[model samples]
Target chain A: MNVLFQILFTISILTNGDIKVPNSGFQPGDKASDFDLKSVDGKNYSLASFKDAKGFIVVFTCNSCPFAVMYEDRIVELSKKYGKKGYQVIAINPNDPEVKPDDSYEKMKVRAKDKGFDFPYLFDDGQKVYPAYGATKTPHVFLLDKNHIVKYIGAIDDNAEDASQVEEKYLENAIAALDKGKEPVPAVTKAIGCSIKVKSK
Target chain B: MKVFTAIISLVFILSASKAQTQVLPEYDTYDSLSAAVFRNNDTTYVINFWATWCAPCVKELPYFEAFNKKYKEQKFKVVLVSLDFKRQIKSHLLPFITKNKIASEVVIMNDKKYDTWLPKVDASWSGSIPATYLVQGDKKLFAEREFANLEELEDFIFSFSKYK
Candidate 1:
């Protein structure tokens, strides 16, 4: 009994010290994990698929949230403007469809088509990718370099309600800074957004 | 004579409708809002950051209402701090509050400086709605997720009570 108790205590200490907490994703300067999620186009995409890309604008968004909907057009515009610059935008829907029916894969396809998205809009099936990246809300972004290093995280800009009234384009500025070989000033930001839906236990 | 009667009825209807209308206080900045609601006093303040558009927030609102109702006589207060857009306050927020007959004190937090104000609420907060902050005389408890039920909310608030 004494030997068994000692072994159990040693295992507990090892587990507690090494394990990463769920949903506490990668922070700045941390190496982000690559995912092979299915896109709305029915094709699988991973960071490795984008061979020529210098960096990626990996935004975790969904179909239903008002804040996500508000930023949809802006996300499209970012892909268009930044694609040529070798910084590709990869959109992912991380909400569990069981919790929010509107975020179903079919609706995501419709949304992607309707928005004329020029980028790969992937679905984080099983609700895996966002938690791995630490996304807490719809429209949260993780700016990663070619080396898969998370350089920035948070909102796309200063404003979520109105794009026209936006004063600072955080994502755009981050890309611009990278182009000039400088670090993003405010490495992380926060914006009021719908909490990422997960099925209730 | 007919016009006089019509005018009197109009005035009575207007006054009666005004009595039914719920007056929602709007705060354009977080500093002013924190000053009013997050008072450093003996009263335990349960400040819930929520919005009308957030489904989880809407789902868990009744629990907050029930909690408020149960604790009204005590040195406790429930303030529903709405993160709804300023433009939608009239069209979306007001109607929802009035229709639900929400008795808890509701106020709009329209400040756009989320990066600055969100950390002030709780350093661990990631700007998600349905977050609850329970406070009394500097003792604070912040929950970044929705309360499952009234008991859960009561348990959260009571957990802070154990401090003092």
Candidate 2:
């Protein structure tokens, strides 16, 4: 695996194509906007209901992404650990079913059911929510306070492929900070995962 | 099959035109061109590498298009590279690029050498989509995450251009 990563790094250096995708909407310290996304059971889940929590966690994730799937246990652990502490964890599926059918509503339901997700799996139909939150990658996490203020925005952990070796749990720290009424020091970290599939115009 | 072919044809025409105007000829292998790729040739090169199946890649493409419009006269060029499979050159690459109407230079670097190629682009890149590298006048900055808006994008460009 180290050799593979080294080779990939070399290729990136060697490839004449030296550029990255550009999107500026998702950044640290941005105020999180309220969302009225529909949950799996056809009910709307809004930020208003969780306005009283010490903090809220909005993770722009999906059912099919390996990065997201690996975090399933941790996400559940997060919800279990934080939900009782007044932090709401909501998962949003921003993929276009017309393009990627595996991310369709039904698949989301089955995956959620099969995985025993304890969080709300919401669907952003027109994709009006992710850009507001500036979510560019899957399993992209946004930690907010009770006032819907953004505390942290980035990956859930340091390691996506290997959960065991995670050195820094970014999301967990953000929640902990919010719980303690202090600002999260390292508010943004590198999130290695699949990108959110916005509808191509 | 007729609809599919029509779409494919449309995609090809669009991408080819953009490439003629903006995209440089792609370097397929990851072991080629390390220093020259970022050698400030007086042209501000914007390289956006993404795949068809990547959602974040699709999400941020419009920003590249917008950047092209905002900086066309200042020796600024946006180059979009499709990181799909080589097989997609005919079936998926052309149509996706064409239909997107991406006015920037578009090329399909359909090589599976990501493990060998992703880091060469930038050591910070975690093999993620929507990653970007901005090069201007011997200055280079790579952003592993996504940007939020045009102002931020412009700031990144201006800041890097000022580098010693």
Model 1 per-residue lDDT tens digits across residues B14-131: 9999976776778878889978787677889999999989889999999999988988878899999998888888789989988999999999887897988897877678888889
Single out the weakest 10-residue window by summed lDDT for candidate 2 chain B: B31-40
Query: Can you write out model 2's per-residue Cα lDDT over A5-76, one digit (the tens) per residue?
Result: 999988886774545454556455566778788888778998886657777888888877756787888888
Docking class of 2: incorrect
**In candidate 1, how many Å is residue B131 off?**
0.5
What are the per-residue Cα lDDT tens digits for candidate 2 across B22-100? 3335556644433434554787777777766666677677888898887877778777776654544567666776687
Candidate 1 C-alpha lDDT tens digits along A30-67: 99999999999999999999989999999999999999
The most accurate candidate by DockQ is 1
Candidate 1: fraction of native contacts reproduced: 0.65
Cα-based RMSD of candidate 2:
13.1
Question: What is the C-alpha DockQ of each candidate?
Answer: 0.38, 0.10
Q: What's the DockQ of model 1?
A: 0.38
Q: Please state every model's RMSD to the true fold in angstroms.
A: 7.4, 13.1
